[model samples]
Target chain A: MRKLKRYGPPILLISPSLFLIGLFVYVLIFSSAQTSMTDIYTNPQFAGTRPHTFVWFTNFIDLLKDGDFQHSLKNLLLYTLVFITGAMFFGFLWAWLLDKRARFEGVFRSVFLFPMAVSSVAAGVVWRWLLNSNVGDRATGLNRLFQMVGLDFLENKWTNNISFGIVAVAIPAIWQMSGYIMALFLAGFRGIPTELREAARVDGANEFKLYRYVIFPQLSPVALSALIILGHMSLKVFDLIMAITGAKFYPTKVPAVDMYNLMTEGNFANAAAVGIILLLVVLVLIVPYLIHTARGDKR
Target chain B: MAVDTSITQRSGDTGRIVGKRFDWGRPVRFIILLFFLIVVLIPVYVLLVTSFKGIGDAQAVRAWDLPQVWTLENWKSAWQGTPGLPAVAPALARTALMVVPAAIISSFLGSMNGFVLARWRFPYSNIVFTLLLFGMFIPYQAVMVPLYRLVLSMQTTLHLGVGIPSLIVLHVIYGIPITTLIFRNYYESVPQELIEASRVDGAGMLRTYAWVVLPISIPSFVVVLIWQFTSAWNDYLFAVYFGGNAASQAPVTVTLNTIAQGSMLANYGAAMAGALLASLPTLIVYIFLGKYFVGGLMSGSVKG
Candidate 1:
């Protein structure tokens, strides 16, 4: 009786969350894995039913050979590379500038961070206009602004360029997210002991040298965490690109968007395959970081 | 450039300058910051300016120009909707109904889980915590198929059309990891002596939590509430899938998307106004409660 009483409350408290996560996250992931191995497609005869046979890696093989999938993977690679680097660079720069005790710090911080609150879909709508590629006398958005300032050379087709148009899509994402990275980097900067800075300075380290050697080294962990967070988010990006380029646009089509398109078309098995592949890629980026943080907590 | 270098050298020498020193870095930094400030606000400028313009004036070719005729017609059309599209006002109400309950329930459940994990340690709790944390990183696409099927089955079996209720449950479930992480980290800082002192008075675990830990959790609660509220309100993927196709059932995000991309596309002013209306709720929350929002974000991302 005492043992039951001792354990019951804590067990009861945690069971609902554990049960829900287990069912929704783990079991559903396993179900998706099962579905990925099947051959389910739309047939008018089986409109409401999901009838299938075990295809055993055929879906994965077909996806590997598919042209659209290949293009999507390429687009994802470029988008992820540009998004991570751009957000990190601007984030760190803004944090560094604000760290110098500038006037109107509160106002500047609010202006930078407010984007984090807006929905990506809303932000994407406005950005689509801003990145308009129309030129000559018909220019608009940044193109028009550039032409007005006599920097006509700076304007080009933003999300219309087939090869690198996805990079333009990353701009709105970076704008919405860089402020978050700034907050993270600022917290990291503040966490460093002041005595460490004073010690580096007393040893004759200048501002540039101090950041290059002492301060930058301490922020590596923050950078790593930021990279992992940004990397996984970039992998699952859907709404922003969807809102900007719509689903039919090929240049910005990513795996997540592809999965949605496939699902809507009743290509359930292929959608499952795409989803499982996305999950695997996210796990590859996230598992080591999770283990690292867990072990750190224990220590 | 020469003056900038001299000021840097002067500041670098002592690391503590006098009040009268003319620092060139100040203007340089201000210019750099102001430049980025303009870059960030350009889209916002376009959003506000276009929302107030007539349809012809809101075209992409003339997006930078001030409206030849500023009017409230777009806001009216967006609010009341057009011939084929539905109004946004009902969707906004549906979103409120969905977000408020989802945020409150998830936060309270997270507090319970956090209290147990943080103070009432059982075996393998760390493993449980790690497993829970992994859920936060997985793409929702991975589970989207099965989740849809599950909800479908429940609707058929229970004879209940799972609409907004399904979305609320999904948000609360997916919200667990982050909310738990935030609350656990918050509660860990609640000195152990408080729990011990309450325990010495013969209170059980639940009583101690109800009386002692619950009172001090207001700050974390605020943080989690604002975070969950914003995320749930901003969600589009799940809202599109689980939220029914009827205009009355969908959230503002989905409705706004349909309005912008539907036949209303010809009316750029209405599309822009719809976008602003969709963004207004969370923007207001952010403008008011930004500090707690940032705190929640940092605690979730930057492990203790």
Candidate 2:
């Protein structure tokens, strides 16, 4: 009774959250793993007639050999590369500029940050209109703007070029998220003490050298944090690409979109396999970062 | 060159030396900032401009032009919807119904869990906390299949409808890791001596938390509330799968997608209006409570 009383309240307080998370997150993941190994058909023709059987790794093997899956993986690789680099570059640029305390700082900051509030679906809808692929006399969106400004060479088929169309899709992703990365980088810039910069200046380190040698090194952790966050988000990107190119559009299709297509088509085993692959890729990017942050908290 | 560098360095130090020196770099910086500002506003300009345009003027070629004829017809049609597509007004209402309860319940549950984990120590609590935090980072796709089946089963066996109520429960569950992380970090900063003093006053853990910790939780509540509100409001993945495509069941995001891609595809004005309408709620929250939103975002990303 004494022991129960001593530990009871805290356990009771945390149990509801623990129970829900366990049921929804852990239990469901295990269930998904199980489903990935078995075949289930939701089609009316197969309903009640087909017996669900464990197919072992057949689904995974099939996905590995599938042309569509290969294309999606390739698209994912290209999208992740472009999205991370573009977001980071623009994020760092805006943060560095704002760090100088320019005029109308509040207005500029709000302008950059406002995109973070809009849903990717909403942004994608607007971008789809803005990236209209029609050219020449029917030029539209950025293309029309380019034509007006005599920068016609800048206009091309955005999200329509088969080989590198995912690059154009990454542009909207960058626009939506670079502001968030800016906020992260801005916080990091502020966290460094003023005394350090003054000390570097006192030692005759020029402005450029001071930043290159002292300031940039201090921001490595922030850069790492932003990279991991952006990396995982790009891996799981769905709605943005979905709204822009639709799920069936092969040029911009990533694994998440492919999984949605498969799931909708009643290919449950294959969908689960794709989902597990996504989860594994995300874990590869996120697990070490989580462990690092957790250890930092102890210090 | 040396004089110019000195002025720049001094401005960096004082941060208020404007107009004291005619620095050449200042104009260049302003030009760069202005260029990016335009880049950021271009799509928004397109959205607003096209939203107000007549159907004839809202074509792809005329995307950058001012509305040749301004009209409220598109807004009306979007709100009231066409024959094939359903109105977004009801979906907006459904989203509100779903987002509010999800935000409130998750925040309160997060507070309690945070209090226990931050202050009340036990064996392997760190491990438990680490395990809970991992759930926040996993792609929902991994669990989407099982979760969908589970909800379906609940609808049949438990008579729990798979509409806003199911969405509320799902959001609250997925929201746990983020909310708990925010609150745990918040409560960690609460001085332990205060808790000890309350304990010396003969109050038990529950009483101490209720009287002591709960009162100081308003700031964290604001942050978590705004974060949860926006995330739940902006969600499309869950809204699509769990909410389904039924006109009565879908949320604003799903409805907006349907409107944008359906017969309204040719009607750019209606599509833009629908997009703006769907984003309005979260945008309003962000405009009004942006500081707390940023605070919540940074807190989630960076440890206190």
Candidate 3:
């Protein structure tokens, strides 16, 4: 009774969140995993009622052979590369600049970071209009600017391009997130004591050499943290793609968007397969990071 | 942090290298900074200017141009909406009704959970935390199938009607991992002696938490509130899937997307106006509650 009393309130406080997370996160994970192995898509109504006959990974096999799924995976890879590199470069650059005592720091930081607050839908609308490709007298957006500058050749269809269409989408994603990554780097920079920089200067290290050796090395963890955050966000991208390119934009289709489409079209089995694949990829990236953090806690 | 950097700059201005007087690169550096600043602000500027333009001006003007004759007509029609498109105001209201409570309730629950997890030791608690932490990383796509089913089942069996209430429940559930993570980290910084002292006074766990810890938790409350509010307000996936495409049930994000991509015609001016309207809440939050937002982002990313 004493033991129960001692532990009771703590457990009581935690149980509601614990129970909901278990039901929503874990139990649903199991159910989805089971659905991926079944033939439920052949009949749409079988989704929520009960599990259908086990198909034993046929959906995944078919998915591998599917052209659009294959292309979507390629798009994701290309998107990740562009988004992470672009966001990190600009983020680190801005952080470095701001760290060097820029004027109007508050105004600049607020303007750069404000994009983080805007919804992806709103961002997509703005960028879509800004990248509009009308020409000559009817020209708007960048096309008009290109014409004014006598560089009309630089203007193109933007998100409507057949090749490298996903790259166009990455521009807006980078714009929205680089400020966040900048904040992360700025925090990392601040966490380093001023004494360290002074010591480096006393050791005959110039500003460039000081950063190259001491500062850059200390920032690897911050870079890794940015990578994981941006990587996963780019992986599960749905809203931005749909908002910018619309649902049926074949060139820019991604797994998350494809999963939504399949599920909405009553193809639950295939959707579940895509979901499981995404889960595996995310687990591959995140589980090790979780373990690393847990071990850090022990220290 | 910015203050420390500025202090360093002011001290550095005292001619550390006395012989090196030709500093021709300063303007170039400022130019580069200004270039990026323009690149970053152009889309927003375009949206703002376009919203003010008359429909013909919206179509005709270069994206860089300020509206020659700024008008409220676009805002009026955007709020009133066309036949096929829905007004932005109701969708904003529905989203608020859903997002506000979800943000508040989830943050409260997370604070309690975090208090227990951090202060109350138990066997396998670390393992439990590790499991819960995994929830933060899973793509919503991976869970969408089963989550959709679960919501449907609740609708039929528990008689929980679809739309805002269902959305609130989903946000609260999914919000657990991050909220718990944030608050647990927050509570970890509280001196153990305080809790022990409260206990020595014969205060039970709940009373100790309520009287001792809750008072000092205001800063964390701000962080979690801003974090949850922004995310719940910005969400498009859960809103679209669960809330459905119905005008009455739709959140502002969904409504704006639909209006922007209207079937018969796309009205860029109205779309820009609606997009700006939809973005105002979170934008306002950032402008006013920026400190808390930065706090949440720092804490949220540090452990990741």
Candidate 4:
């Protein structure tokens, strides 16, 4: 009772949020636990992984044999590489550009960030239409433009093309994101004291060398944080893929879409397995970063 | 965190503001900026021209055209497409319902939780706090399988109302990691004496939180509010799935997807119209709230 007295108010105040979280996190996990035994596909009955079912690793084995799963892995790896590198480079560059004391800094900053405000699904919708190649209304997307200019050699169903579709999907990803990267970079830039760069110049350093030696090192923590954030965002990306190609397209598949497909088809066991693996990958990147930040230390 | 390396111009102690003298880089900077704008505007310009063009003009060899021939036909049809109901308005309303409450409650609770964690030294505090922090790195996908079953089970066993509540709850979970991180840092920077002074009086927990913490946290509050608004308003994954069959419950993201899903030959025009209309709320808010957004992202970046 005494313990309850001290905690009553906070518990009562936050119980709604806690209960809400518990329903989503704990209870849902509990429900999906039935998949450990039953054959989700053929048998339907709770026959269990008994006399007939001795294959512990077969589902995972079968998953690897599937070409779509393999392609999705390749797509995620390539997309994460291009998407993060591009988003960071441009995000930083835009931030750097806006760092100058200028009359139109605010206007330009807002202009860049405006894309981020639109949902990825919506952005995908617009971009998908822009990329369509139908002769009906000419569908004047990028692919269409290339075709008209006799750059038809360069054109294909870009979103459906296994080799180039990732890039096409990533184009909008970068567009929606470059502003966010710009914002983070601007923050890091502002964090820089004015005297440091001037001092670098006094030491006879050029802009390139100065940034390489002085400014870049100081911004490491923020840069790392940004990378982690973008890494997670890129890996977990869904809406754009769904919008541009719906769920089942070949070329641009990622793990989130794969998981969504499995779950939608009611293959909860395999979906759980996939979700667990994806979680592990995200954790591998995130855990160390949190440890670094939580050491009660700052630059 | 200081990145300002412009020490060459910082020589004068008494008279010079930080680069008050016109560096030659200023006008050059604007010209440089124009080049950047063109790169950014290429797709936007293409989308714009194609939106205004008729079918033949859309398919034209030279696609670029000034909007000389103005026509309200696509807009009229789209607005009139589904009887009296239009896509953009209802989506906006649904988006607002999600954004506003999520922003307010998340920020408010976030600041409180942050304050308690940062200031007090109760034994089990960090453990509880860390459990919440567990959600920070665990991609929602990992826990989502368990979580999805959890929500559905609640609908059955616990008799909880589902759908929007379940989704809003999930969003709140997402919001906590970020919002708490922001407030934790912000409150740490806040002076301890202010709380001590209030406690010396007869102020209890609720009063101290209301009277002391909330007023001083206006800036941090604004920061979290904008962050929550964007993440919630722009959410695609949660809305598409957690929101069920009712079109009314769907936010702009889902609605936009539905519009694009159907048959429309005027792909360019409809897409531009849908995209433009969907993004309007955030753009309008941004125009009014520009300064706070920058300050918020910077401060939040440091917290992370």
What TM-score, over all chains together, does every model reach? 0.96, 0.96, 0.95, 0.85
RMSD of 3: 2.8
What is the lDDT of every predicted structure here? 0.85, 0.86, 0.83, 0.69
lDDT digits (tens) for residues A159-276 of candidate 3: 6766678888998999999999999998888777777776776676765787788789889899989998998888888889888878888988888888988987888888998999
What candidate 2 gets wrong by more than 4 Å, as runs, is: A43-49, B1-20, B58-61
**lDDT pick, better of 3 and 4:** 3
lDDT of candidate 3 over B209-273, digit per residue (tens): 89999999999999999999999999988988998755778789988888887721445888889
**Clash pairs detected, candidate 3:** none
Q: Name the weakest run of 10 consecutive residues (lDDT summed) in model 2 chain A.
A: A41-50
Residue pairs of candidate 2 with colliding backbone atoms: none
Any runs in candidate 4 off by more than 4 Å, and if so which? Answer: A1-23, A26-38, A42-57, A133-139, A143-157, A201-209, A297-299, B1-7, B10-28, B46-63, B66-69, B83-86, B156-163, B264-266
Between which residue pairs do clashes occur in model 1?
none
Candidate 2 chain B worst ten-residue window by lDDT: B1-10
Q: Tens digit of lDDT per residue, candidate 4, span A25-55?
A: 5554444433522345422322233323334
lDDT by residue for model 2 (A2-62), tens: 7788688888888888888899889988989888888774643224366788889888898
Looking at candidate 4, what is the lDDT of residue A181?
85
Error of 3 at B232 (Å): 0.3
Instruction: Give lDDT tens digits, candidate 2, residues B1-304.
Output: 3233443465376454556666766667778989999999988998898889986784556668898988998898889988987788888999999999999999999898888889876667788788788889999999988887888888888887677888888899999999999999999999999989998999999999899999999999999999999999999899888886647887788888888777435677787888899899998998889999999889888753
True contacts kept of each: 0.65, 0.68, 0.69, 0.41
Which has the greatest lDDT? 2
> Residue B128's C-alpha lDDT in candidate 1?
88
DockQ of 4: 0.41
Residue-level error in angstroms, candidate 1, position B161: 3.6
